[model samples]
Target: MANQEKKRGIGFYLLVGVGALFVISIISRDKNTSPTTSTSAASAARPSSAPEPPKAPQIDARVTARELFEAYEKNEIAADNRFKDKLLEVSGKVDNVGKDLLDTPYVALSTGGKFDILGVQAFFDDASLPKLANLSKGQDVTVACRCDGKFGNVMLKECTLK
Candidate 1:
């Protein structure tokens, strides 16, 4: 009789454990299915309207070629992270206004030495080639550019004379 009671108790515990697991699995399955169905219904209702295009990021700061060089000299990684991908309006003496290795037009802003080696390099859009062609060494120019961060020198892309 005692043995039969012990066996019945073990069977009851096993059944309870299985029942708890089944309930938990069903609850979890329902939770997982609900979100997917709601998302599908929401998309089906909004199929015609397209999402808006993202706006261009605003300019973070402006500085001259000398100031920009000084910032990088002080802390290269910090300056790169702070100014990378930000729009800028930089004004300085023209160092070089010519073609790059890829034949793309560029305007180098002087940080006070050699034209090509020690300066901020600003690459122009194809439309600005004619305007860039007119720029000469030693002339002052202010250009709006998207900063590409410092390599050997500070680099700017999509530059336009301002």
Candidate 2:
């Protein structure tokens, strides 16, 4: 009967639709998880030859941690104009040394108050973990880094002992 034929056609189309969706999902999953795909993408983005050694960033200024923190606390805009993104040699008495919420190592340098909550925060790379482990609170230290402006604390990034 024509009615039976129509039902069969609808069922067939539904089954085909489901099969097509399943195939598409598998293909998309493969594209997402394929190691070769990621490897090829990484290769395309990298240089073909040997990479050169990284050069040290030039020092733009030198100041104590208190001086740096006070500068930002006084006038954020003026301080940023003078030190933001510029490499600096900052020396201060260490207040703390620990990893941040994201596991980034940092050293907090005192900015002068006996019960101060904020200080200059200097972030170091993972390679500096051993060096950071050797630091103690109240010890004098100097670091070279780029000033990343203030966010509660004056942030210094890519820091290394100087």
Candidate that would win on TM-score: 2
Best by lDDT: 2
C-alpha RMSD between model 2 and the true structure: 8.4
Residues 47-114, model 2: lDDT tens digits: 79987889977899999999999999899999999999999999999999999999999999999889
**Tens-digit lDDT track of model 1 for 83-129:** 87889889999987888889888988899755446668999878997
Q: In each prediction, how many residue pairs overlap at the backbone (N, C-alpha, C within less than 3 A)?
A: 0, 0
RMSD of 1: 14.1
- List candidate 1 stretches off by more than 4 Å: 1-57, 114-116
lDDT of each: 0.86, 0.95
lDDT score for candidate 2 against the true structure: 0.95
Which 10-residue window in model 1 sums to the lowest lDDT? 111-120
